[model samples]
Target: MKRTIFQSIREYKKQSILAPVFVVLEVLMEVLIPLQMAKIIDVGMAGDGNLPYIIKMGIILVVMAMLALIFGAVAGRLAAQAGAGFAKNLRHDIFYKIQDFSFHNIDHFSTSGLVTRMTTDITNVQMAYMMTIRLMARAPIMIILSLIMTLTINAQIALILLITIPILGGILIFIAKKAHPHFIKVFDEYDVLNNSVQENVNASRVVKAYVREDYEIEKFHGISKVVFNLFTKAEKIVAWNSPVMQFTMYAVVLLMVLIGGKSIIFQTMETGELTSVIVYALQILMSLMMVSFVFVMIMIAEASADRIKEVLNEVPEMQNQPNAQKTVKNGDIDFDHVDFSYAGEGGNLSLKDVNLHIKSGQTIGIIGGTGSAKSTLVQLVPRLYDVTKGSVKVGGVDVREYDLEALRDQVSMVLQKNVLFTGTIYDNIRWGDENASNEEVQRVCKLAQADGFVQEFPRGYQTKIVQGGNNVSGGQKQRLCIARALLKKPKILILDDSTSAVDTKTDALIRKAFREEIPNTTKIIIAQRISSIEDADQIIVMDDGKINGIGTSEELLKTNEIYREVYLSQVKGGEDDEK
Candidate 1:
């Protein structure tokens, strides 16, 4: 985990190292200042009537103080740069890893949970990092140097600190252990709160439609209360450090004043030396307090580190072989005795023993009930999920044997959920082919039956779409998504209910355009309405994860019971509605 996280410090390594170096210089100057004060008090002020000696000490003291301020400023600047850079690289790493994750990997992490890890968790780690480079480096060095200076002044007084240091250290360690679990639980609750906010905002229309605004408010308040309670518990554990340090610090100071006062009265220790000792005692205790604060921050960041490492360490479930095939010559797809379980080999299968083949340019239609695994079958051609047994071959090559990008590039899929980003219509459509010419974009939009309405808008294809295309009608969004897929000019195009929102007339026109203009592109249309696939070269009927029937529309209507029942229900219903 440490190795994975620290690797993100790539270009920031020098800054990370140098920040602490400056901190060391600053600590050295601070330690020397106390000693210089002692010298000025004991010799220049008390023993010497020489003005030059006092003036020299005063100048030296000013220079050291200035150097300390300069070092501290440089250290702070470097620490900020290093910390921000580390966070930037870490966010990049985690986001890239998430992009490579398969559906199975994504299933293990909630959207809100991943969002928290990338944001809140990384912010915590960044704060800890800045503190580590600045205060963390200075504290230990300051403590050790101050202790040595105190010992030089008087060992008996210093021994009192030695005993107090161990007791304070024990108290901090105990608080840290108790506080850590609460912090971890607090971050988990944070994920829940973010999830609630995200879900509510995305579904605000639905909430208001059903008049459930009050219910959503109550739910959000409950999650917020959970977060508040967890944080309060964690902070309660951490709050012990301040009082513990103050009590121990004052205890040591009181003892030093008693012992050193007696020694001064007996003429055994100078008043200047006793003054320096008190200053050193405060410095040492302040350093310990800084360490305690750093410790608490570290305890919090430890959980964030684990969450980040989980994303970095997750291996993609499927990978191409080394020196893999890079070309897909055609759209011919063959599913040979394929068996699949989303849960891996041991889990219950979602697709079982599915065998089918399609020629390079043939149009195939798939129809099935809600749980018949229709989408599962089409997803395999793009290598979205590997079959648990047997093989799904595209272009006569096993998907795993080909480079993932090269294979996916040849297959354009319009998923069941048609999505449009917040951009001009042209920009969204051009996602299918980044360098598509204006003429080509217009041609595809016409073929998808989207050109007419798009042109009706004032700015035509340049009109901006709201997020998720909510500003547009559902049928319009579907047509635009279909146009986007058509722009790909891919070897195979799979539309998984992409035309469901469009009216029957528009859907028929889009399919007619496909048959006429892109006849050579293999089309796999997954549809709920029989009319959508009725004209395909062949149709597949799936039931309970297996093929129930495969034939032309007329043949299936005559010979297949399931197909016959669905066809009569749809066809007669249409005629009855006409009457």
Candidate 2:
């Protein structure tokens, strides 16, 4: 929390200064007013007829009070503005940093963990900043200034307070140290609760389908209960400080009254001096209590700050080289003994000693059973996850040597799980090429066989898609994803089981369009359905993480057992159907 507080203060250094300055002035006003009160009682009342001097002092106190109020308000406004502005920018930076993270970094943290960091964690830090500016700043200044003022009044009475202040300060520091760890635990529980809730929400359909509503509810309740328990424990510890400080102050006040009354009766102190001394003692104690409250707030902020720093300090796995050269497309890809893994989990290689070459304008097909590493192989082309061993080259140059954006621009992938943002059909399609025209969208939509259904909607291309494109059917979503990739007109296009949802007729139409419209592009199709890639110029059959066979459909049927099995499973009267 100290780290998060410092980070926020560092972000808005100018505004933080205003808080302390205003607090100092406010404390000075408070200290001076008591001195003026003593003067009015002792000097003004003692005079025979100097009412004007008393009136003047009263006016001066009022003016000083007004100035303090004005400065306090100004400082408060500045602090609020700074805190809010700092939070807004920090949230924006965290979000953008998450977006920039490569797959390696993304997989390290859960979605819920990242969400918690961005939202709940940041909010906690923001609250701490606001509270610090509003109360924490004034607390210390009041304590110090009141102490200085009290010391000038009566050394004996001030000496008693001096003893109590250190004891109260010691209690504050001890509680702060213990409470810091609890705040950390509270935040961790927050993440757990967020993760459970997010998982349940995303899988609500599955929960309903499985009729496991009770099970899910029980799971959520368990997580919520743990969060509540942690919160209660932390709050209980924090709640002790205020009451303890109040009780301590009460004890000190009673002692001061008894001792002060005896001093006045014994003529060691005058009546007005006794009254002034008591007022100063209360002021000093009250200020110390405020300081204690500030200490508590700082402890919490310090914990929050540390959590935020962990995220900001994380080093991204992938970063562009200094003055990296942009890839100049020669339309070729070569994989030379490429090996990769998800991270940690040891070297369970996704692609091992694999070699492949794709020249300009060639269409290649990759087919394999589940866990065969097809998607992982294609993902390397765009450098989504860098290969742990061996080089993946684009246009005769290693992909690592090229600018990341330049490398990505030459390749377009329609992932197996098609994702669509909320927008009009045209806008979604235009995502492939932000500057693509209406004609280009229509051409690709027609080629992908998506035009027929898109035209059926009331607004046709202008129809608004809901979040994740849930408004459309699965097949429609796949077609739109395909259309989006097509609009890029990229040099290398990867269709990863993108046609799985579409019927054979629509798939055939899309394949035909690919041949005519994108014949010059290097295409890699990863499919489970044999028919989807059976007619490719070349097909690579994979088993485990290695390529088992590389050949045309007719050649593979006679040579590769895995390819033969896949073919036989999909096509009845198999070899004869090829004729």
Candidate 3:
């Protein structure tokens, strides 16, 4: 997983390497300053006024301090540059990978989970990367060099660090192991909290219509409380880190003072050597604290790295075969003994042994009750999901043999749920064909019976649409969506109950325009209203993932039991409304 994530640091490899080199230089300057201080105290102040020698060592100390400051500043700038660049490239790669995901791949992950991985998880990894390059180098080099300096001054005081370091190290390790699992649980809770906010914002109108704002607030509070408690549990364990380090630091300092004071009284160690030993002891203990801080960051980043690796290493479930067919010849579709299941091979099939053929330039209608797999059947023609048993062919070629982009370009599907992005009406329709002319855009809107209401606005086609087209009525949104699909000029057009929101007269006009203007394109309509499909060339009756009937309306009235019952009930209801 680390190998996969580090590959995103493409162009910033130079900066990543240079930052640590400067950190090493800064550590060297810091260690030498203590040695210079020992010289100033012993050689210059030994005889009651070697004033020239003291001034010389003091100037050297100031120069070393300034050089250390310059190196530290340069290292920090380089680390920031490398970290921000790596994050940008990583986000770019993850988004491109998501674009290639098939329907099956998308179903395996929740929307909120993927969003968190791209955003919060990546931020954690970036911080860890920056610290690993800078502080990881600075802490160890400072510890090793400081220990060497202390040993040369006095061996007895240096032994205090050797013993105290291990005891402090053990405490940090125990605290890290206990706090890590809580951090993992805290991130998982973040996904649920984000999902709750997303749902409430998207369905704000429904909540207001039902006056359920209080209920939504209570539900959100419940999820937020879980996240808060998990974070608190993790932080409480980490809180032990500071006080333990302080106690260890103070205790080691006192031990150094007591041992060095005894040596001074016995005339074994000089005053200059004792002063340098105290400075080295403080440096070594502070470096250990920095190590503990880096370790904690690594624990959190390890959890986040696993999530990011899952997205980067995911092989797309579908891809084009070698030398795949590039062009769709015509709109003829055939489903030959096809069986499909959402749960791969061993699960219950949503579409069962479906056999149907549609000719080029023919208009077909499909009718079924709820959950009868109406949308599932049309989704196969565009190769949204592959068949498990048999094959789905478009233009007499198996869908798997065709390039995915070429096949989907010819088959335009306006789904059951109409969606419009935030843009002007012209901009939204232009998504169908970006190169379409202004006249071409207006023509399709007229055919879909959308131009009348759109012209009622002062800006005509240039009126801005709010998010999700919330400013428009349901029927207006439906008509605008139909106009967008018509601009595609595809070889095959599938409308899955898309006209349910419009009135009967407008629906008939749209169908009439399809018949007169684009008669050569194959059309498929799935509808709940019988009036919508009564005039089709042939209608299909589906029940329970199987074809129950297939014939003309007149023939189905006498032959198919399911079609006869549905037709009689609708006709009688129309007569009652008239009376």
Candidate 4:
């Protein structure tokens, strides 16, 4: 875990090194000042009231104080820079890794869990890094230097302080071991809590429509209570640190006074030396306490570090082959004994042994029940996932043998669950072609039947869409998504139930527009309605994980029982509704 995180400290290596260097200098200066103070107390004030000697020592002490202050300030700035920069790079690395993920990779991780890792986990690591460079580096050096000075003054008092070290170290280690697991559980609970919030906000309309606000609040309370209980347990263990430190502190001080006082009275130890030893005692014990605090922080951040490493260590399931084809010459698709699974090998296959060939410029329709893997089949065309067995070929070349970006650019798919970011309607549509002119943008919208509704809005194409496009109707949202795909002008366009909410007339018009305006583009429509695909060149019916039948709509109705039944049911339902 340490190795994984340290690699992200690429450009910040200089700042990381400088932070500790300045911390050592600051601690050295601080240790020397106490010795000067002891001289002023025992020698200058007591013996001959040596005014000139005291003035000289005092001036030296002031200069050391200023130097320590400057060193501390510089160390603080460097630590902040290194910590924040490390986190910034880690976040960028994690997000870019996520972008490279295949469908199989995303299947194993939850959206909310990834969000928590990128945010809360990274923040924990950042805090730990800052403390490591400052307190972790400074405390040990200060303790060792102070102890050396104390031993020189008098070894007996130094021995008394030294015994306290192991006992405190043992207790702190025990506390850390007990608290570490609880900290890990705390962030896991945070993932659940964040999931709850994301679910509620995204579905607020549905919650309001069903009058389930009170239920949502109760559900939120349940998760929040779990998180609170977890943090309470972790903190209770950590809270033992303070009293342990305080007790050891007073115990060492009392022992120093009792032993050193007798030595001073017997004239074996000078008053100035005894005073300096007392100062060193405080320095040594406080250094131990600081170390304990740093240990606690590392213990907490260990869990976070592991979580971050999970993301950083993940290798994307699919990668482009060496010297892969960069251009997709055509949209022809062939499924040659293809198989797929969300799990990689020896896992249940979601799609099985499917064979279908689509010529360039042909129109195909895919109809299937939920979980029959309609979306899974279409996703393969763009290399969103690699086949578990056999091959999926585009332009007579295996998709795995093409550059990922080049493959995806040739295929445009509007997913089942689409999203519109917070931006003007024109801006969202321009996502497909950022440099698209106003004329080109309007043309796709017109073909999607979205231009009419968009113009109805006071701001037309410039109207701002709220997050998720909640301001628009479901049908309107679907049309806008289609317009975005149309702007891609891809050779192959897959609409995965994209026009479900639109009226039958509007759906027919969109299909008509596709035929007239983009005749050479291969179009695949996945729909529930039989009427949506009746005019297709070929239609496929899927059952379970296999292709049930594939033929033109007219041929399927005459020979395939599944197609015959569906067509009659829909035709009868339309007639009955006319009554």
Candidate 5:
């Protein structure tokens, strides 16, 4: 346990050593002050009382106490500063590591588990480090120093003190070991409770729409109940330690008084000496009690440290290779006999034998049924999840060979679910291009058909958006996301059913703006609506992760049954509009 504690402290090397060194000095002052009081009483007040000597010892005690207080304060400040700094660095490291995790690694821990590790788990370790340095380090020093002083005063009474120390130590050690596993259980349940609450909060709208409020409340209560039970068990184990230590101290003090009285009567110890021995005995027991308290803290910290280590030790699935080369061109994409599956199961492919190529100035549309793997196929282009088989090349180079950042920068995707941060309209739009001028942002907003509503807001471009853009309509949020993506002027732009919420008129305006303003960029539009992709230069029809047909809309309508069926079902008045 001591080695583990020291190893943990080494993470804050200089601060840890300095804080404890000051604390040990303060403990020395504490032990010396009591001895000085015994001297002032026994020697200064003995025979013809030495007034000058008593005054000198009194002054010395006061000065020592003052110094101890100053050192205590300094140690406390240093411990807190060190604890906070360690926690800050730990959180930053964990957060940055989490960012490097690919979809596979992230899914293993879940969102709320990672959040719990970053906040609650780190806090436990920080509190432990602070308390260990501020209080625990002094416990042993004070106990040992007080015992030495007690033994020097009288060995007989100190013998009784020796017996109680082992008994109390044994009890504390037992309780600490018993409570350690429970503390771990408590934190695990805490993760479950956090996950439950977070899930309900993020999906509150869906819960309300389904009218499952009571059901959700029941589920939350169930999770909270488990956490409460675990906490109660841990508290019970910890609560037992204090009373048991106090009992042991009381027993030792009673025995010491009896033995010291015998010594006084036998003339083997003076009255003042007896007084000093008893005081030192009490100090020893009190210091042991403080040490026991530190032991309990150790148990809790051990549990939390294990939790923190779990996150810190996690190996991220996606990391840059040593000195990987980056792609150099603007926008050219090719999928060569690509096969992929979310399951990564043997011989199971989400996309199979797929080959496609798009040049820098081409517009392509992708259409498929609900389970046709349309989104998965495009996601591979951005390397969100790498393909299980074959190669996806961007700019005539394999994407895996390109620097991750450089590859992602060349492609911009507006997913079906548009996510918005809590910020002003201008700030959200600027996410695409951090250094974009106000005119550039405004231009994209106009292009995405978002300028009119944005201008009408009370603060116009500066209007604040709630998280998820909850304050705005769905169409408005989609348009804003589109504007953000457009602002990047990406080499390859992907719209994965992003314009579904907007009315046809707005959609047409956005399409017109895209054609006129950014005709040189390669575009991939994945849509379920026939009208949405009817005018593309090429349309690919997908079925069961395989490309079933690829041709212009007119050619597909005449020759492809699947494409014709989709067109007939969506076109109002059917065959007449199709013709």
Candidate 6:
């Protein structure tokens, strides 16, 4: 896991390495300052007031201080650079990995979970990385060097630290062990908190229409309170750090003063030597305290690191076969004895033993009630989800054998709940074919019956679409999405209930344009309204994860009970409307 997360520190290796080097230099300067002070006090102050020697030592001290400040500043800047750069690369890798994930892989993670991992989890890792490079490096070095200085000046007094150090170390270990579990629980709750905010924001309109704002607020507060309690528990455990550090520091200082004063009185230690030993003792204790602080951060970051590694270690379930086919030859689709389950093998099936064949350039319409697996069937053509058993073939080759990008480029799918990004209408349509010319874009919009209403806007194609295209009517959003798909000019176009919002007249015109203009394109339409698919060359009726009937509309009207019942009921309803 550590190896996986640290792999994102690609270009920042130099900064990461150099930051610690400067930290060493800074610690050296700080350690040397106390030794110099001992000299200034002994040789200068006590040696009959040697004025010139005192001035020389004072100047040297100032130089050391300035150098220490310079080294510390450079180390801080480099650490910041390394941390921020590492975060950017990590986020890039995570996002690209998500793009490669199949729908099956994506189902294992929630949208808000991914968001928290990329944003909050990565931020925590970044801070820990910076501390590891800077303070972590400084603390240990300072402790070792300070301990050496103290032992050199007075070994008997230094033994106090050895005793106090372990006592403090044991306390810290206990705090760390107890606090870590709470931190893990805290970050997991962060996922729930973020998910709550995301769902409420996305469904703001529905909540308002139903007048459920108070309910949403109460639910949000419930989630927030859980997060708050978890974080409080973790922090309360960590709060033991400061008091423990203070007591250890004071105890060490008291022991040093008493022992050193007795030694000085017996003439075994000079005043200057006693002062330097005290300074070194303080440095050692301070370094230990800094170590404890870094330890706490690592404990928190350990949980975050695991979350990040979860994403980085995930292997995309779908990938191109070796020596994969690069180009799709045609739109011919063949589903051979296909059986699929959302759960892995040996689970309840969503699509069961479905066998069907679609010729290139044929217009196929599928009508099914909810839970009929209509969308699931077309998703297989683009290799969105691989079949659990048997094979799905496109252009006479198994879909798994084709390069994922190449196959998806030729198969354009406009879903029932299609999405539009916040951009101009031109920008949204150009997502289909980025290199398409202005004339080509306008032509597809015309075919989709979107150009007329689009032109009615003051800015025509340049009009800005708000988030989710909320400013537009439902039919307008659907037509604009159709225009975007038409711009792809793909070999196979799948419309999964995409035209339900448009009126019958507009829908018929769009289909008429498809017949006249793009007759070679294979079109598949999934719709609830029978009128939408009555004129189709071949219509499929699906029921309970199986194909109940497959024929032209007229043939199905006579032979298929489900199709006949639906057709007569719709026809009667139309006559009643006329009355």
Q: Against the hidden true structure, what lDDT does model 1 obtain?
A: 0.91
Better of 2 and 6 by TM-score: 6
For residue 578, model 3's alpha carbon misses the true position, in angstroms, by: 1.3
lDDT of 6 by residue, 4-91 (tens): 8999999999999999999999999999999999998988998479999999999999999999999999999999999999999999
1-579 in candidate 5: lDDT tens per residue?
Answer: 234323444457778778998999898898888788878877999899999999999999999999999999889888988888777877877787778877777777867778887888788778887888877788878878888888888887777777778877788888878877877888788888888898888788999999999999999899888888877887898788878867876777788778878887898777777777777777777777777777777778777777667666778755667776666486788999999977775857889989988887688899999989899889998788888889998888888877788777778899988999999999999999999999999999999999999999989999999877879999999999999999888888999999899988888888888788889888899988787788888999999999989999999999889999988777855567768
Best by lDDT: 1
The TM-score between candidate 4 and the true structure equals 0.97
Model 1 ranges off by over 4 Å: 47-50
Window of ten residues with lowest summed lDDT in model 4: 158-167
lDDT of 3 by residue, 1-579 (tens): 298999999999999999999999999999999888888887898888589999988999999999999999999999999989888988998899999999998887788889998899889888888988999899889888988888887887777887887888888988988999988887788889888888899899999999999999999999999989988998899889999999988888888889889988998887888888888888888888877887888888888888888888888888999999999999999999988888989888888999999998888999999988889999999998999889999899999999998998889888888999999999999888999898999999999999999999999999999998999998899889989999999999999999999999999999999999999899999999888898888899989888889888898999999888888888878888899
Tens-digit lDDT string for candidate 4 (243-262): 99889888888888888899
Off by over 4 Å in 5: 1-12, 345-348, 572-579
Candidate number that wins on TM-score, 3 or 6:
6
Structural similarity to truth (TM-score) of each candidate = 0.98, 0.93, 0.96, 0.97, 0.94, 0.98
Error of 3 at 190 (Å): 0.9
- Model 5 Cα shift for residue 217 (angstroms): 2.6
RMSD (CA, Å), each prediction: 1.4, 2.8, 1.8, 1.4, 2.6, 1.2
Clashing pairs in 6: none
Model 2: lowest-lDDT 10 consecutive positions: 1-10
Tens-place lDDT per residue, model 2, 326-427, is 855766999998778776336678778899998978888999999999998999998889888889998898888888888888898999889999989999
Per-model CA lDDT versus the true structure: 0.91, 0.81, 0.90, 0.91, 0.83, 0.91
TM-score, predicted candidate 5 vs. hidden true structure: 0.94
Q: Which ranges in model 6 have alpha carbons more than 4 Å from their true place?
A: none
